[model samples]
Target: DRYFPSSKLCSSCGSIKKDLKLKDRIYKCSCGLNINRDYNASINLSRYELAI
Candidate 1:
């Protein structure tokens, strides 16, 4: 079971959730960050390219 639910933690705002209901498709953080369920999870495993 390789399930991942990192959406509960917002990378942009670093918001961590204690318990995320399965019925919730939307993620709301106290930092005022809003994102879709899938999108939010993707962000956790996502990274961008940058040059030094």
Candidate 2:
């Protein structure tokens, strides 16, 4: 089971979701950023790899 910490990734800005809620299916952030949960995770992971 590949689990992406959606609650830990910013759904709107693609940043790390520091204070995310499990109940949030759709990311409603003030930054006007919106995206799927998995997409954020993949992007995060990719960025992380590139940094290293």
Candidate 3:
């Protein structure tokens, strides 16, 4: 997942914001979803359900 931009991606709408910076703490999507960056990343990761 090193190459994946999980933080820059909108977990709600699946939209990618390539311009998102590391300093951005809030995750906002055009789909009317606004959440914390860490929370959003966890949500997106949970969706994958990867087997370890």
Candidate 1 per-residue lDDT, tens place, 13-50, comes to 77677687878888878888777877887767563212
Evaluated at residue 52, the lDDT of candidate 3 is: 25
TM-score of each: 0.69, 0.54, 0.79
Where does the lowest 10-residue lDDT sum fall in candidate 1?
43-52
Of the candidates numbered 1 and 3, which has the greater lDDT value? 3
Please report the candidate that would top TM-score against the real structure: 3
- Residue-level lDDT tens digits of model 3 in 1-52: 5666677779889999888788989988889989999999888777755732
Instruction: Point out where model 3 deviates above 4 Å.
Output: 50-52
Estimate candidate 3's alpha-carbon lDDT, on a 0 to 1 scale. 0.81
Predicted candidate 2 versus true structure: per-residue lDDT over 1-52, tens digit per residue: 2464544666446556656666666665567777665666566677656766
Alpha-carbon local distance difference test for all models: 0.69, 0.61, 0.81
